[model samples]
Target: VFIGLGVPLYQGYGLTETSPVVSVNTVEHNIPSSIGRPLQGVEVKIGESDELLVKGDSVMMGYWQDDEATRRVINDDGWLHTGDKARIEDGFIFITGRLKDIIVMANGEKVAPVDMEHAILEETLFEQVLVVGEARPHLAALAVLNQKEWEKFAADNNFQDAEKHSEQVEQAILERISDALHEFPGYAQIYQLGIVDEPWTVENDLLTSTLKMRRNKIQDTYQDLIESLYKK
Candidate 1:
């Protein structure tokens, strides 16, 4: 939305337990940016703590005969507890982030790093970004620059050997990221940026086969860089 890409897109939110779809923005009754109202016969509500809950026929009866496992997710009332965090306004659902991925800063500020990471990726300069500041003062990110785009950036800036690390290159990358984050609030802005030398891959154990990042692994691999980001 920041760059006005002109793509007619609609976002939806759901979990596998909800038959994979609970709320989706459709062309007929679309709220451009919202996850739209609940589907017909599907009821959705944000629990007291802001967790999204859904109940309806579309929801699975149980986890394929595993009552013990099913009971853990579906309450006696039959509401499916989607692990996602969200808010409902005027019947539309707006997902914030995953409950588990929330980061709490030292000053009691809460930030969702995924939101920041996604906004930065919209610039297409970074292929991967993991925002981290749990229990720290401010937000920091481990970013893997898109090699092709980085090379173009280097060429445009009259630099050589773009693959090699340089302070000037880092600053240039940060500038692009900063521009991409113009819509984020001050507290959510990235305070420090760490350029990751290698792209995350399943072979490197940084990513799962499904392509999800292994957060713990990345943190362990970049422990020193993470510490340097917050050095006095």
Candidate 2:
């Protein structure tokens, strides 16, 4: 029972150091969220720290002009230490997140924001979302809504301007996101929402060319919005 909005998506995982692709799922063997099994001739294993390690011909020789950095990542044993924390189950690799991106909430709860963001986006109308709650009591999100969807919402709701950030709009979005997150853990649910008018793009430095979120850049760009989410 695999349902998709349109065409099915198969996730793959790799880094620049690994010639870009270490694993991929084919149409014949797709697992919704898993990154698939390691490609032929590639050996992947989880280290004691839960970091993904790769060994094989696809791995890069070394970092250019940075021997110390290269040595730190590629050990003498020829294993390329990938910073991503992941798990291997039934021959599938499920990437959790970067070692540094795990949020430690005030109550000592560990929350992986990416997992929450994925769940939030499943039913919400947002085009992009980021969960933030590093040392806070509860999580919050910065959301970028689909422009066309927002226009339709505004027209139906009798809003004079779709661009305006109104209370009615915020409440509607919160309700939708809340419904999507009902099954998530309490610590992972978003308590606040910050709506951004502009879409994240590589031109704006918010997203990489590969469409990955540049988390640090986005956080810096929306510093005020993030602070407001924490305000009483």
lDDT of 2 at 146: 80
Whole-model Cα lDDT of every candidate shown, in order? 0.84, 0.86
* Best of the candidates, lDDT: 2
For candidate 2, give the lDDT of residue 3.
Answer: 51
lDDT by residue (1-232, candidate 2, tens digit) is 3354577888898899999899998888889789999999999999955789999999999989999999999999999999898999988999888877888899988887887788877863679999888888998889998878777777887775644576677777788888888888777787788999899999998999999999889999999989987993
Give the TM-score of each candidate.
Answer: 0.73, 0.72
lDDT of 1 by residue, 1-232 (tens): 7328866777787777777889888778777768888888999888845789899999999987699999978899999888788888889998877877888899888887777888888987789999999999888889998889878877998878754467677677778878988988788878778888799999999999999889889999999999998892
RMSD of each: 4.7, 4.5
